[model samples]
Target chain A: MNPVKVILTLIPFIWTIGMIPFVNRVKPIVFGLPFLAFWLIAGIFVAFICIKCLYHIDSKNNQDS
Target chain B: MSSESMALAIIFVFVIGITIVGMVPGMNKKMSLEEWAVGGRNFGRWLNWFILAGEIYTAFAFLGASGWAYARGGPTFYILGYGALAYLVGYYVLPAFAPLGRKYGLMTQPDLVEHIYKSRTLGILTAVIGVAFLLPYLQLQLTGLGLIIETCSYGQISRVQAMLMAFSMVAVFVYTSGLKGVATTAVIKDVVMIVAVVFFGLYLPIHYFGSVGGMFEAVEAAKPGFLALPGGTKALDVGWVMSTLVLTSLGFYMWPHFAANSFSAKSADVLRHNAVYLPLYQICLVFPMLIGFTALLVLVPALKTPDMAFMAIVQQTFPGWALGLVGGAGALACMIPAADLLLSTSMLFSRNVYGKTIGKNTSSESMGKIARVMVLVLTTIALLLAIYLPNMLVNLLLTGYSGVTQFFPMLVLGVFWKKATKLGAFCGVLIGEILVFGLILGKMDPVPFLGQHLNAGFVALVINMVVFVAISAMTYKPESNKG
Candidate 1:
């Protein structure tokens, strides 16, 4: 497996689990949204970027082989 | 005509039109069992995307997500977390699954299981369990369709009437066109759902609370702890959200329909692209949650049945014709996914359960005929369950997930770990399922297990992996396993 793709695959878990302990409170709102809501909303977009990166690496891996 | 009548007319016209269009592709083609069950092992990128999206984001997501948001609040964020988690797994796992399907000519989930384990008994068991779990899920869509029709008609039509009319049409289209029919309808269904969701998500908040930001402000003031985890519901804590997210994410791919859909992909690249971009649809899905929150403040007092939150909000907000369009979209959400579920369950029954036991030497033509009949039987059983055994939409889905997720150990480990023995796979799934049933029956799901209040499915999954690994170690016959 490509290291980049592996990292991308792990990103969603890391972001999801990582935010659990700290991002539980609803203060310091970002983008007019509460902290927890913003975290999940941002996480969705970040996950999109991460998956797109994985797709690129995956295509490269396929080509190299 | 009144706006309600006009809207109802639009919904009926759309449903009838889509049914006609949905059957067009399959009308021109003569289908074998493979084609009927798995789209003849040939679907390009966009078609596969539509089918998978249509399958995943069902009426439950359209309605239940909003309901959970409006009612449960913080716990609803679990929906957002799991979409990415599951798609990431799909990115790696689905490529592996597609090649196996192509290589073995596998047409369903149990076919792949039978291929991997080489155990006919286990294959049949998986098929039975898969269909059993899917029934409640199919019932969920029926309930959603019933909600849409009753709400749109301003109580003009009864729930039973709406369910019968919608599902009979779904059963007919699915029996005639099979997977191709489901895919073709999904294209229209998804497009309609996206439009309706976006319109409601943005419009509800702005109309009721001035803007999205203002909506959150009002929610914060009106209901304390509404925007955070461990919201009003005692069971829906931060831990429960995390546990449910992980379990459902892993469980998402284990659904028989999801895996079987992979067989239709034309290439691994198609699956990969779908995995990556599917999260975009997730972004769209979370909007309904926003609508739900807005509904809480806008719809005075509160709705008794929270699952009707989306429909209630749409009825209050949009005029009759637009409401009809929204109703049509919501109806499509239920029908498209329900059709796929019906197709998958019937295929599972015919290919694995009935074919394995009684019709072992039956020709493919006979099996195809059996599958078509099974679709009618399964849908009718689901309709009965919907009518008699009604439950909360998301609750039914979570229960279904807990049972089907048992297949994960056999699926993921069987692919990666060559040491995984067939005996281990069978025993692991059986124990996991029995434990799930015990937990649910005992009302100890999300109970204190190992000092953590994990979802019952995740708890069972842990026990399952341990048993599988231990048995595989004990049953180690390296040469026999290799061949």
Candidate 2:
């Protein structure tokens, strides 16, 4: 619920689904792949990190009971 | 033996082997309705993880992703990030429901609604809608099964025959073992599918074009527009990609069966942990799309059925036994989820509708029996429709996917908002379904003015949320009234 957590969550969303329209280009390929493909593939890893950070700080996810 | 016979033998043996593995757990027990539906809610992390991800990764993932990539191009990548995002949403929504699942011993999604709003009628309404939407989806698995077997057998086994065999096996598997069966079988299906997809996805592009980049460059040269959004397609523009992702990710866990499956988790901790790591599974989705893009160029004659790209490429490249592994994995992907859908839908009907109404005093054992009977009835209905009217099921599934997203308002508001009235959820869902079916059935999807790219279902969801909030505000009474 804190500002940091909220921003962390939004980071993945912005990269994965939110920024698709603006970045829908074939040129300026990253690492030998097209821009769109590179963006999508990298987005998964970004989501994984953001979710991992969110999980540790989340009050409910930490409860043992 | 002939090449066809060798492949057929391997495919059938592999399918039956995994079917028995699925049936091994919880055999020889008289399970109650709760036990039958959700493995008595004692599943540990690994088993819990498997079934949670199992339903979404189906025959559709194996063949359909490649098929979409082959036919639809850049549109196929839409499938990639949505699952990860769904888990992101689950990071919040699932923990909210975990205590409720344990506290009330809730068994189905309708049961959650009933408890949230304190209305049995709402429970019955959701159960009916859930079952209706699920049947069409079940039909899709059967049709997918038929295609896999037909391709595996080199046209020796008819699609109808494959479906019939799958139908019988799936029904009996669930009847004997329930959710445990689905989970155990999911292990084999996931393992074989990961191997097949990762290998083919990497191998094909590198084999033909010398590198992944080379393959993409070749595809770009061969078909210039094929590497980006709306690539080689008219309707699936940038808006389609963005909107479809939102619609699917929001609707992902709303399917009736998903709600029921979530009930089986041991604790909130396990489910939350799943959300963190589950996106790793998204890696498999990428492989299929790569294969699809590779298939676009590698085939000499080109494929007639776009959906056939995965199998067509597999058959052309591999030996009999290797192709058999792909075929067997695809069959399990179709069968296990169909079995789970049948079981959970029947449980929702028998428990929420039948037990709460006509069979008030029926024991959980009898309810399980009743659910079993309903399972057979539903399976027969799906089987007949799959055989008689295949396209009808596909259309219903499209509508069903969008229709279930309508539940997002009811569930999120009902749980988090607290003032969400029963009447509000009822009216909102009804109106949302109407808008979804109206726009989709009338073929007005993407709307006229929204660049023809946004999904129709996403449009309905926004409107549904507005109506739900407005109606709840009007109908909410103070706590003192407590009606």
Candidate 3:
């Protein structure tokens, strides 16, 4: 129900939709890595960020409660 | 043993070792019934993350997804899309249930339903529906394990023999560790599955078709539908795709094992944090589709069973060592989830149904004993069903999904809407489930009424919603109870 939380959650869903049409569009390089490998690694990094954000929010809420 | 058999033996031994560790008594040394069923409601964030990931991505996701892709072309991508969609939906619904689970120390979907409805008849009906649907779903995992063993052994071990071996291994761990066994095995399964999927997803396409572009080119040439959005005669048609996605997304959290795991978490924060990271677990699925796409290129038309597609590709294409590893990972994927399903359902049968109704004062030790015994009985029944059943793996899973989703109206409505009366909830579930089962068995076409391709689940959900809203509208509201 939190607007910020909802927006953050939508990030991955939107990212996934973008990747769909172009997933097969292979690139020679992304930061000196194959496109597929690079994309997956980047996604993992983003996931970590999201996890950290969520953890912070949850901890703050817990403190308040 | 042959070289392949020896490799499998080592993997099996490792799996058994983990299972034994899980079964050790002190791992879950709590006296309360809630502690026994839901891991004392004290799993940490890391454990919760791993457990939730493991439960969601079963051998079905690994083997079944690729198999679907190979057999059905682009339509199978819906599996990946649907899974992600389901997780997103769970993120929203899980928070509502976590507090309730903590307050009531609930263990199963029926426990929550019965609490809200306060009806013994509804409780029993929910349990029966859950167990019935779970039977085929569990059997599908067993069957997946059997195929993995049979394929890796190269016919030295028959499917039935492999199934028996895998089933016994699961039963032992589940009997010993209960949910603890499932949790430990899940960590191992997730590691193996993620590594295998990522490796294959990247390696196989390039290995077989030279590149992703080449893979698509081949697919377009052979089966144009593979490039189509919905894929294959619109097998992923707009309506079907949306319905399947929404149904499964809403239905995923309703599974009894998930509820049990949610309750097991140390705090509600653990649940929230775990849900945020859960999508990462599904990253493995992207590769299974690649494997499926690769299989279509390399495999001949004669080799086209939905279950065999992934296995056939590995056996025919990969080297002996790689094939062995894939097989081991596949078996672990199936075995971990099967153990969890078995243990969770046993806990449900013992604590929720038996303990609540038959013996109110059953001790934790007695309940644990009953749980182990039920594990044996349920696994035996599921084993028989797996061996004797004639349906394809994917179809069998859909049947279970549809049947289990009947509980959706009860759980989702019960928590969010205070106006939802106990009578309305019970009547809604009953009418919905009966109609759904009747349609499935009778193959009644609801297209006449809705003009859309409707399955048992969609039909049941419609009737359930109607009854719930109408009855709730008419009936008097109970005093504002927090639960």
- Evaluation by DockQ, superior candidate among 1 and 2: 2
Q: All candidates: CA RMSD in angstroms?
A: 1.9, 1.8, 4.3
Spell out the clash pairs found in candidate 3: B23-B177, B86-B249
State which candidate, 1 or 3, has the greater TM-score: 1
Docking class of 3: incorrect
DockQ of each: 0.71, 0.72, 0.16
Tell me the lDDT of model 3 at B48: 78
Q: In candidate 1, residue A30 scores what lDDT?
A: 76
| Model 1 lDDT at residue B112 | 86
lDDT: which is higher, 2 or 3? 2
- Give a tens-digit lDDT track for model 1, residues B144-229: 89988888877777899889988998998898898899999999888888888888798888887788888888888888777887
Q: List where candidate 2 sits over 4 angstroms from the true fold.
A: A59-65, B450-452, B480-483
For each candidate in turn, the TM-score is: 0.96, 0.96, 0.86
